[model samples]
Target: MDFRPVLHILMRIVLITAVSLLMCVPVALIYHEPVSPFLYTSLIATILAACAYGGRGKQELTTFKRREAYLSVTLSWLIVSLIGALPYLFSGAIPGITDAFFESVSGFTTTGSSILTDIESLPKSVLFWRSMTHWVGGLGIIVLVVIIMPSLNIGSYNLFTLESSFQEKIHPKIRSVGRRLLYIYLSLTFIETFFLLLGGMNLFESLCHSFGTVATGGFSPKNTSIGDYSPYIQYVITIFMLLAGTNFVVHYYAVKGQFRKIKQNEELRFYYKVTFVAGIAITAILFFQTDRSLETAFRESFFQVASIITCTGFATADYLLWPSVGWVIIFFLMFFGGSTGSTAGGIKMARHLVALKNVKHHFRILNAPNAIIPLRINSKPVSAQDNNGILTFILWYFMLFLGGSLLMAWLGSDVPTSLSSVATAMGGIGPGLGSVGPASNFAHLSDSSKYVLCGMMLLGRLEIYTMVMLFNPWFWKN
Candidate 1:
C-alpha cells in the first residue's frame, strides 16, 4: 500500500468536509441552532487535514491503480463518515458515539435509516447537516471531491468507477462527465424544492425534503414523513423520486438533445414500465380490499410502490398494514432497485436485465446444440466480461443477504423482521416489514443487530463488491 496516496486522499477529504461544514454553519445559525461545536469541529477537521498533507517527504503522489482505487473509495467513505459524525456528537442531539456514527453512515450512504425516535425535535443546523450528508452522499463523496479539485482528475476516474454503481462508462473524460452530472443533480434539486414550496411546504421543509428527494435518501423533516403534508407535496416528492432513480447518463443525453438515445435506452423503458404496472396492481388491490377511496388508494399505492422500487424508503402511509399480497409485492420490489448511474441502490435494473437475457440464452443453447447466441442490451452485444461480472455480483449479493438475515434472526428478531431488515439494509432501502416497517424505526433492535444492519447498509451502498474485496487477503498483498 502506498501511504502517500492514501494520506493525500484522506487529507483532501478532510479539507473538503471541513469546508462543507463551514458553508452549512451560517444556515444553522440563521435557524437559531447552536453553531459553536460545529465551528470547533470544522476547525479540527481542517487542522487534521493540514497535518496529514503538510509532510516534507520527497514522495510524489502515486497514480492510483485499480486496487488503490478500491482502497481509496472505501477509506474515503469510512473516514468522511467518522468526520461527518462530529456535528451530531457535538450538537448533543445524538450524544452516543455509536448512534452518531450510525446516523452519519446512514446519511452519507443515503440509506435513510434513523435510530432517532423523534426527528422533529432536532435542531435545524443538525438537520441541515443530516440532509447535506444525503446530498453529498447521493453523488458520492469521491466523485464530489474529484469535481471540486481538478488536480486529482487523472487518478480519480478509477476511484469514481469504484464508488459508482453502474459498470457502464458514460463518457471518455471523467471531469466533463462529473460536471454534467453535478449540473443535472443541482437542477433537479432546485426544481423539486420550488414545487414543494408551491405545494404548501415551508422553505426549510421544502429544501430539506428536496435534498432528500433528489438524493433519494428519504430523510424527511417531519416525523410522519410525507404523510403529514398536503397531497400536492406528496405527489411532488413522488415525481422527483422517480426522476432521481433514473440513470443520469440518460438525463444527460436528454439534456443534450439526444431524444432517440433517451427513448431507446432499454433500462429506462423497463424501469418505468415496471413502476407503472406495479403501481396499477397495488392500487387496484388497495382500492378493492381496503376502506380507501379510489383516488386515495391510487395515491398511496403509487407513492409506496415508487418508494420501494427506487429504494428511496419515504413513507406517506404504512404499507405494512396492507393486505398479505400487498406486503409480498413490496417485498419483491425491494430486490428490483432503480437504474444504474442513479442515486438509488440495490442490484441495479441493467444488471438484472443482462442476467435475465443470459438466462434465456442459456435455455436456447440447451435446446439447439449447434446454435451460437449473443446476449444484447440496447442493441449492443454484451461483453463476456460484463456478463460474468454481473452474474458474479448478483450471486454474491443474494448469499450475503441470506447470511445477514439468518444472523439477525439468531440475534432475537422474528423471521419477517429479519428478512426485511436484511433486504432493506443490503438494498439501501430504509424501512422494512414487520417491526422495522415504514412507520417503525430501528431503535428496538439489539445493539449487535444494529451494527450488523449498519454493515449491511455499507455493503449495499458501496455495491457489495467494493466492501467485500477489502476482506480478500489478496487485496493487501504487497
Candidate 2:
C-alpha cells in the first residue's frame, strides 16, 4: 500500500469537509445561534487537513493499488466522520467525544441512529448540519459504489454491472456516472423538498426532512420523528424514500424515458414485491389487532415498511407496541435492505433474491438430478462467481451480526436490546427492538456499545468486505 497516495487523498476530503462546515454558519445567524461552533470547527478541520497533507506528489495516485483503494475508501469515511463531530462538540450539545463520535458516525454512515433525546431543543444549525450529513453521506456512497467500486469489481459485484445485458446501458466513466448520479441525487432532494413545502411543512423542516428522505437517512428535526407531521407530509417523505431507495440507474433510464429497461429490472421488481407484501401484512395486523382506523393502519404499516426496507429510520408509529407477529416482521425485514447501488443499507434485495433462487434451484435438483436448473436474474444466467459472492456476502453479514450481538451483550446490554441495536447499526437502520426501539434513543447505551455500533455502521456501509479485509494480516503480507 502506498501510504502517501492514501493520505494525500484523505487530506483532500478533510479540506472539502472543512469548507462544507461553513454551510452551517448562515443557519446559525438566521436563528441568532452562536456561529463560533461552526467557525472554530471549520478552522480546526482546515488546520488538520493541512497537517494531513503528505505533499508526496499527485503522481502517486496513478500508482494507487487495490490495497490503497481499500485504505483510502475506509479512511475517507472515518476521518470525515471524526471531523463531522466537531460541530456537536463545539456547541456543547453533545459534550462527550464518544457520544458525539457515535452521532457523527451514524450521520455520515446514514444510519440515523441518534443519541440526542431532545432533538428539537438543539440549535437549528446543528439539526440542519445533522441532516446535511445524511444528504452528503448518501451522495458519497452513491458515487463511491456506483463509480469507484465497479473498478474494484469485487466491491460492486453484487451491485449493478458495467452495462450488462440485464443492466441499463448507462455510461461507466467516473465523471459521467458521478455527474449523472449527482443530478439524480439533487433532483430527489429538491423535488421532495418542494412537495414537503406544498404539504405545508415550513422551509427549514421541509429541507431537513427532505435531506433525510432523499438520503434514506431518517434524522428528523422533531423528537417525535414523522409522527408529529400530517398524513400528507408523511406520505410525501414515504414516496421519496422509495424513490431514493430504488437503483439510481433506474432513475437515469426513466429520466431518459426508457421505460423498457426499468421493466426488466428483477431487483426492482423484487424490491416492490417485498415492500408490497410486507406493507399489506402489517396493515392487516394493525387493522385487525388494534383499534386504529383503516387509513391509519395503512399509513403506519406502509410508512414503516418503506422505512425499514429502505433503511430509513423515520417513524410515524411505534411498532414495538404492535402485536408480536407485526413487530417481528419489522425485525426480520431489517436484513432485507433496499437496492444495492442505492444509499439504503443492509443485506440488500439482490442478495435476498439470489439466496431465494439458490433455495429453489436446490429443491428442483433434488426432484430431478439431471435437470438443468440455471439460476438467473434479469433473464441472464448468473455466473458462479457472482452467485458465490452474493451468498458469501449474506453469510458474512449474519456472521458479523452474530458476533457483534454477542459483543454488545458482553458490553452489558440485555439480549433483545443488544441484538436489535447491533442489527439496526449494521443495516444503517436507526431504531431497533427492546430498549433501543423506535421510541428510544441510543443515549442510554454505554460508550463501549456506541463505539461497537460505529464499527458496525462502517462495516455495513462498505458492504463488509472493503473495511473488513484491512484486518487481514495477509493483506499487508502480500
Candidate 3:
C-alpha cells in the first residue's frame, strides 16, 4: 500500500497546518486577548511539527501514487480541522468540542454558516483567526505548501490535482501554477482591502472583509454579514465577490494581456450570463414585490445574487424575508456557483455547461439515430469520459444534497430549514431559507445536525470524489 509515503506526506501537511495555525498567534497577541488558547495550540502544534520533522528524514518521499495522494489530502483536511478547533475550545468562545469542530470545519471548508450566535462579542483575535481559515482554505493549504517549499517538489502535481478539481491548467509546472494563482489571490485581496478602506471601514474590518470577499468566504466581522455595511461598501464587495468567483486562469490571462482568450472562455460567459439574468430577475422582484427604492432594490438584489451564485454567502438583505418568488430565485442560484477553477463552491458552471451541452447533443441524436454526435464546449469536442464524469458528479451532488436534507429533517428541523440548510451547507453557501436563514445562525440546531452539516461542507469543498473515494473498500486494497 506504500503507507510510508502517505504518512510522510501527511506529516508534512500536518506541519504546514501547524505553522499556519501559529500564524494566528500574532493576532491574538496584538489584541491583548487571552493568548493562552493560541499559545497552547501553538505548543501542541510545535510538538506535532517536531514529530513530523523527525519522521520525514527516516524515509525519503521521492514519488507518490494517486492512492497515497488521495489519502494524504483527505486526512490532511480532517487533521487540520481538528487542530483548528483548539483555539475556540481553549478560549471558551465555543466550549463544546462538537460546536467548535463544526465552526472550524465551516471556516476551513469556506462554508460561511456559523454556530456562533454573537459573532461581534468574541475577541478580535478569534475573529481574525476565523477569517484567516477562510483565506488559507480558499486556495487550499496543500497548494500553498507546494508553492513555498520546493523540497516537496516530487509528485507535487498529483497533490495539486487531488486538491484542485478545477479544469484549466495555468502553467506547465505545478509550482509555477501555484505561484500565479496565489499572486492573483493576494492581489485581489489587497485591492478589495484598499477599496474597502476608501468606503470608510477601519483597517481591521477592511482586512477581514477583504479576506472573506477574495476567498469567496462569508465570515464578516459584523453579525449582520455585509448588510451592516454602507451601499458603497456593499457594491465594492459585490464586485470583488464576482471577481473572486471567476476562474483564476481567466485572471492569469488578464494579467498577461490576453483579452481574446478571456473573452472567448465559455464558462466565463455562462457565469456572467447566469449572474446577470438572475440578478436582474431578483432585482425586478424586489422592485415590485416590496417598497424598496430602485437603487436599494438593485443593490440588494445584485449583492445577494452575486453572493449566492459565487457561493460567497455574504448577504445584504434577509433573503428569506423577501417575496416567495425572490427567495425561490435565490435558492436556485445556490446550485450554480462560479466558474470552474474558482474558489466558490457549488455545481460549478463548467459542469453545468457540460450537462447542458450533453442535453443538446442528446436532442440532436433523436433527430438522426445513426449520426455521430460529439459534445463540444468552447468550440472543442469533449471526450465521452469527461462528459460522463460531469454527469456522474452532478448526480452525486444531488444525491448527497437529498440525503443530507432528509438527515437534517430527521434530526428535528422543518422541511424548509432542512432542505435549505443541507442545500446551503452542501453548496458551501451560508444561510439558507428558514431557521438558518441570513438573519439566523446555525447555533440552535442539535449537535448531531451541526456535525452532519460539517461533514457535508467538507464533502462539498473537496467536491465529493476525493473524500468519497476513501470509503470504497477497493480504494485501499490498491
Candidate 4:
C-alpha cells in the first residue's frame, strides 16, 4: 500500500471533519446544548490532521493513481464515519460506539437508515449535524474535497469518477463540474425546504426533511416520516424525490435552459414512465385491497413506491401492514432504483434498461443466427465493455444479496426478513419487508448481522466494483 496517498487523503478528511465539527459547535451553543465535547473532538481531529500533513509540505503531495483512488475513497469514508460518530458519542445521546458509527455511516452513505427510535427527542444541533451529514454526503466528500483542494486537481477526475455512480459525470473540468453540481444540489435543497415550509412544516422540520429528500437519505425528524405531514408536503417531497433520483446531468441541462435536452434524454423519460406505471399499479392495489379513500390511497401508494423505487426509503405508511400484493410490489421495486448519477441507490434504472435491451437482443440473435445485433440504448449502440460491466455488477450484487440474506438468517433473523433486510441494506434502501420493515429499526439485529449490513451498504454505495477490486490480490501485487 502507498501510505503517502492514504495519509494525504486521511489528513484531508480529518481537516474536513474538524471544520465540520467546528461549524457545528456554534449551532450547539445556540441551542444551549453542551459544546465542549464537540470542540474537543474538533481539536483532536485538527491535531491529527496537522500531524499527518505538517511534516511534508504541500509540494510533496503527488497525484493519486487509480488504485490509490480506490483506497483513498474507501478509507476516506471509513475515516469520516469513525470521526463523524464523535458528535453522537460525545453528546451522550447514543452511548454504544457501534450504534453511533452505524448512524454516522448511514448519514454519510445517505442510506437514511437509523437505529434511533425517537428522532425528535435529540438536540437540535445534533439533528442539524445528522441532516448536514446527509447533505454533504449526498454529493460526496471526495467531490467536495476535490472542488476545494486546487493542488489535487490533476488526478481529482479519477477519484471523482471512481467514487460517483455510473452515469454522474458532469464535465471535463473537475472543479468547475463539482461547483456546478454543488450549486444545483444546494438550490434544490433550498427550494424543497421552502416548499415544505409553505406546506405547513416548521423551518427545522423543513430543513431536516429537505436534507433527507435532496440526499434521498430519508432521515426524517419525525419518526412517522412524511406520513406525519399534509398531502401538500407529501406531494412536494414526491416531486423533489423524483428529481433527487434523476441524473444531475439532466438537471444541469435543464438549469442551462436546455429544455429540449431534458425532453430528449431517454433515461429521464423512462424514469418518469416507470414511476407513473408503478405508481398506478401500486395505487390501484391499495385502493382495491385497503379501506383508504382514492386520494389517500393514491398519495400513500405513490409516495412509498417512489420512495422505495428511488431507494429513498421514506414512508407515508407502513407498507408492510398493507395487503400481500402491496408487499410484493414494494419487494420488486427494491431492485429498480433511480437513474444513474442521482443520489438514490440500488441497481440503477440505466442498468435495468441496458439489461432489458440485452435480453431482447439475445432473443433476436437466437431467432436469426446470421444477423448482426448490437444492444442499443437511447438509439446509441451499447459497447460490449459497458454491457459486460453492467451484467457483472448485477450478478455480483445479487450474489452478495442472497449470500448476505442467508448469512443474516443464520444469525437468527427469519428467511423473509433476512432476505429483504440484506436486499434493502445492500441496495442502500432503508426499509425492508417482514420484521425489518419501515415501522421497525435495525436495533434488534444481532451485532454480526449489523456489521454484515454495514459492509453491504458500503458495497452498494461504492457501486460494487471499487470495493471488490480492493479485495483482489492483483490490486495489491504491483
The whole-model lDDT of each prediction reads 0.80, 0.88, 0.80, 0.78
Compare the candidates by TM-score and give the number of the best one.
2
Error of 1 at 37 (Å): 2.6
Residue-wise C-alpha lDDT for candidate 1, range 6-87, written one tens digit per residue: 6677787778788878877788879877887679889999988988787513343335554655666778788878889999
Clashes of each: 0, 0, 0, 0
Residue 76 lDDT, candidate 3, scale 0-100? 69
lDDT tens digits, residues 1-478, model 4?
5567667877977887788777777777878998876788788888889887864344223456666767777877777788888889998878888898888888888787788888889988888888877876787833633332223332122221222332234334655776788899989999998998888898878988898888888888787887778899999999899989887767777788977656656767778888999888888888898888999988998898789877887888998888888889889889888877688888878777777888899999999999998887656566676677678878888999988888998999998889888888877779897777899888887778888888888888777766787999987897
Q: What is the Cα-based TM-score of model 2?
A: 0.96
lDDT of 3 by residue, 37-99 (tens): 877886786787677666555554446566766677677678778888999999989999999
Q: How large an RMSD does model 4 have?
A: 3.9
- TM-score between candidate 3 and the true structure: 0.92
Misplaced by over 4 Å in model 4 are 55-62, 141-172
TM-score of each: 0.92, 0.96, 0.92, 0.91
Error of 3 at 46 (Å): 2.5
lDDT of 2 at 263: 92
Give the Å shift of residue 465 in candidate 2: 0.6
Judging by lDDT against the true structure, name the best candidate. Answer: 2
lDDT: worst 10-residue window of model 3: 154-163
Q: In angstroms, what RMSD does candidate 1 have relative to the true structure? A: 3.9
